[model samples]
Target: MAGAVIVHHHARYKTYPGEVTGFVFFACLIASVGGCIFGYDIGLTAGLTSTESFLILFFPDIYRQQKEQVIKNQYCKFDSQELSLFGSSLFLSAAAASLFASPMARSFGRKWTLFSAATAYILGAFLGGVSTTFPVLLTGRILLGVGVGLCIHASPLYISEMAPAQHRGMLNILFQFMITVGILSASLTNYWTGKFIGGWGWRVGLAFAAVPGSVIALGSLAIPDTPASLLLRGESEAARLTLQQIRGIGIDEVKQEFDDLVAAAEESKAVTKPWRELLFGGKYKPQLTFALAIPFFQQLTGINVIMFYAPVLFKTMGFRQDASIVSSVITGLVNVFSTFVATMTADKVGRRALFLQGGTQMIISQILVGTFIGLQFGLSGTGAISEQYAMCIVLFVCVYVAGFAWSWGPMGWLIPSEVYPLAVRSQAQSITVAVNMVFTAFIGQIFLTLLCHLRFGLFYFFGAWVLLMTLFIAVLLPETKCVPLEEVAHVWRKHWFWREFMVDTSADARGAEMRKRIALEMS
Candidate 1:
């Protein structure tokens, strides 16, 4: 029995020390296939609603209306508002569903929670594809949102806990990369199916998500659950084996980590408090603040506007409606491709550089876009969307989204996971992710309002928000690269840079120094 060796499996991981585990990355990609569904479902909705081409292909009768009657009456019009409600329901359901994920992972464990999410995904996809009425679609979206909420919340926790310190950023950044790939895929898939698949094809588009859901389901069987999860359940040996598999270093390297986790858990008196403990109680306050704020700033940047309406934004420039969506696909391609840059650059360039560069670029891109939208040359005066001035809007948006994709998209999740102590990773991650979903829900729900009424105001507002977030992040976000996630708290809890002042006061001093440094450079 002592000589009997147990074969261990890792589900999906990003980094282990300096080495890239090909098998690990491959499995992770497969498990991450859920993200593809997440991306495809949300991104495909825009094409389903706004792309006139989708209408012509699916319901030619609706598109080819009698000029004299239906044109004048507007009865049973293509309900853009209804579409918004359906989409908003999905987001709201997701935000609400996220509340359930931590407890699920805590109670049922990560493996089963993911399996449950997969079940929800399949059911949602089925309902969406077969819906005979608008209400049915809304219901399906809500279901899909539940699956999405669970995946978004748990997947990163899985990768972060599993990836080795050396390669943690590369591995965890998969969430951002997959999301971009999901958006790109949905836009392209919608364009292709709406154009080529023809009648009822849009239904097929919704149903396609089931494919990834199934893949994640199967892939889930391939990887072991987190060591932390097993330990939380009092399976110490299983936890140690899992830690060994994930870190890929001999047990010696992570033996301390495992012990630290065990020690931390024991020292806390196993305080299994309610979620409200995290929200208002002193024990979890710093992490709670971070959890709430990371997602807030991420959404405040108006990234979803670009994600959902990039093509429409492009349409305002000179691209034909169809061409605009195609251009949107190109932007998504940039996102996916650039996310690879994160894998390469995240540990190398570090979170701070990427964020600073990305934030500065986002501000510039937004201002340029606002400038173009404000010019009113093509949008209001209507010489053409392609007027030399208006085309700049398209160019600027592309520039802005590329910046966001490479930076906040990944770092937002990365920082939240790392910035908190491991004792509260799941709970803190849940709140941050829930906050993110809420922001996404609010902004996503209001696209029609922003585009319809205020138009240019949305751009300036988001631009300003990004500028402010830049200040916040430059001040508060500690450099986490090469530091153990468990040790990350020390960066904020102790101010090595300004030892004379309290860490809080030192953080303020650092923020001011950062601002002055940026100002001088800008000047």
Candidate 2:
């Protein structure tokens, strides 16, 4: 927060620099392709349910038995538990990869770690495509998860640091917007390829993930390393040169800015601090608590529950297989468009209102979904959802997705990165995201089974996810919009005076010596 002020000296400013900002935007655009890869791989998993390659890879015998028994449309059938494992393996392993990837990323330069991840990503995709058996396919998914592990951390970090501070929020949010785009791309790809070419089209879709994953890996080689990170590693001259190259600033200006950032980074070391210290320590415990809890609550909406099993859901809603996959494409489109609005408005709208809107709408949507399901059974008195009332069910679920895209989806990535301090940022971001994916794994499997066995009953679980999320958001959510990342902990601190200055607020405080230490360090 201390060095957040953007200095634009007229004397230092030359004539209009045509497309300088454009080039920077392009660089970030290319670098963030990893986000698209992450989104595509994860989002495509559900839609892949419509693909025969996915089925053949998991159910070789189903196809063979169909040849012998002539079971007609039931060629790909599997037990609920078996089907659940096949669908959920990708998320479960990615969650595991995310947990360890966070700390290692801090030590490794962001670019190199991502490169390593890309190799794994590419290999995973190829293997997943050719996998003849279940174990191989599962292995492929785990490897892809390793690649995603590095990307989910490094991609956003790269965007934030490379971006100008004034525009950082939206630019960083663009990473998530790209995520929506990737998901949409995957869903549409799945729909068209599966419907037109038949279910085996997943081979093509799985192969497509490799393209962006490879681009990000190669692209990382092109960009200069982040100046701040170099400064942290004692490569000050190199850091200054990198900053000048990227910022187009005079040597003196860049040097002064670099020193100030490092100085503040050092001072903030003592405040409840961000990330690792920010979440775990005494002063930052509450802020950290909110930071951790928000993501926990975000996933509870059972959003992934829907995403991972959307095709299965649409089928239950009474669509044929192809129609169901096409509907998933529509959901993907809604997700992409809504995220675009969020990227534009999050900073302009500020954080509090969006967070509130997101949580509140989720609650409404889930309750309505449950109500619609209950009515379908109660009024129709049959397991089938009535055709007349179907629109309401689809629209409410769409509204829930829109709310999430506007709020939690992008904000999940934005808030933690912004709220945490420099040192702990990587560590904490990794843990928060890891937990998000871990739960996604657990719930993703459970929800698919529930949808089949319980039918309309699946909405009840989501309704509960919404209820718990609402209470957590209402009570624990912090207003982080416009708050500089470095100083978020200071405002959120609970110790009366500590709340004021992020240390002992006044001489009367118990930790006066600690306060003095922080004050001197700050000065």
Candidate 3:
């Protein structure tokens, strides 16, 4: 069967020829620009909302009242509801846009979908940068949300399809790393702009999103559509050529891969079902469950809460405005660096292990953070928190970010891209991304309000979820370390106990069986 042949090729072509490798790297890098935009949108608001200059220009009444409170040595306050709306608007629009991402990708193809998304980002950035009213700015954010939805839905799918099985995890995870880079870039931009430009800092910070959006729009032209998409469209010869050019292997090797892809494509067509059947029917029940569960658990980790409000969280812990913004930058740095760790190790350590290890650590970090904040509130009330205790909270928050970066941050996108069959990959990915955005919006919308009331208890709420996530990953997620995409369907069919704990050997057996089945069909 082609699956067996693919496994043999996996062993033989441990590294792609230089040109193929370069093309794959370039393609993934270009697609990853969407990730940078996603990060920037998420990170920009953290600083923008915290900037007094921004507040004075947009929310003068709250800014003036806060200033008076500051003058009286009382804690300054902003409208929590307004801030929540400001942060959650993008996710709201993103969730709505995600509903259409699958159809767009399926109808127009991944490359064009990304190009359109980049265009949306450019328009959104322009609107945001020049907004004279809050509604205009919110509308701009809603536009960016459309772009974010398309990009998040398409980028990882494109990368996963293009990348070789052995390197797919790392290459796809690169999207998350780029997101971290974007966050870090936004954080630095906010710091410099806030320090110098004051009132106009957020506008400049937001406008910078257009730079990467432009890069993606232009750079996408250099890459071809995925062979899988081509095969789906019955362009077998074109798919063959693409596999040849991107793989840079010998004729026999290229033919072998082409055959495997065609076999998978044929199988997909044979079993093609409507979206209702694909999602709810027994044939794809496991895949659908996995697709939905992973993204749901990913958001439950409370990572977005921190990304959306890190500076404000720091301020609540007693740091000055500038210091809190600086602290958020540090968190961005940790996020970027730790995502790099995930990129390097995702293939090496396997997805399931990282999920388990990272979830455990996140649970601990959240608990500790909750404890420190609780002690500060209980012991000191409105008095100054001890510097040591404040530092502890910051450290634990970094730990929590590191845990999320190395696990859910990357795997949440990567796993769905791999697990589903190519036929429904786009649709499944759209559903999963929508799930992600829904939870992100829910958390982002209420986090500030929660902080107003729950205060340190918010950490406890997140901690409880992390514990559940740890159990979920340990008990459910099958290891997909080096399993070829064509054969991943078999991974879900194994017994639940084996899927949880003994996936490596089971994947091998499943791959062999898959190969035999394809061989029989071909004969």
- TM-score of each model, paired residue for residue: 0.84, 0.83, 0.90
Best by TM-score: 3
* Lowest lDDT block of 10, candidate 3: 9-18
Please, what is the whole-model Cα lDDT of each candidate in the order they appear?
0.69, 0.66, 0.79
Candidate 2 off by > 4 Å: 1-20, 60-79, 196-199, 252-256, 264-283, 378-381, 452-457, 494-523
Best by lDDT: 3
Q: Give the TM-score ranking, best first.
A: 3, 1, 2
Q: How much is the lDDT of residue 52 in candidate 1?
A: 60
lDDT of 2 by residue, 374-422 (tens): 6666433245555566678778878888988888888877776676656
Better of 1 and 2 by TM-score: 1
Candidate 1: tens digits of C-alpha lDDT, residues 1-523: 0111111121111122324466557645655665676677668876776556445544445446522233211112232454556567777888888888988987777777778888898899999888877667678888899998888877888777666666779888887788888898898887777666435768878888788788778888788887767777788898887766665657655555666556544432245574555565555455666788889999888887677756555654446767777777877887788777887899887898889899999999988887776665323423344456545665677788789977888898888877665556677878887898888878877765665555566677888999998987787666777565544544555433322222333333443355345335433
Q: Which runs in model 1 stand beyond 4 Å of their true positions? A: 1-23, 52-80, 316-318, 378-383, 387-390, 496-523
Using TM-score as the yardstick, the better of models 2 and 3 is 3
Candidate 1 backbone collisions, by pair: 11-223, 14-171, 318-386
Cα lDDT for residue 329, candidate 2: 75
TM-score of 1: 0.84
lDDT of 3 by residue, 1-523 (tens): 2223323213321222223378888988999888999999888988887888778777777667766664311122343676677778898788888779887887778898899999998999999999989888877889999999999999999998898887888899889998898888988898899867437767888889899999999998888888888887788788878787777665555654566677667665654563765665545666788778888888778898788777877776678878887888888999999998998998888998888888888989998988887776753235566779877877888999999999889998899889887767888888898898888888887776666566667788888988887887787777776667876755665646534432233324444466556457654
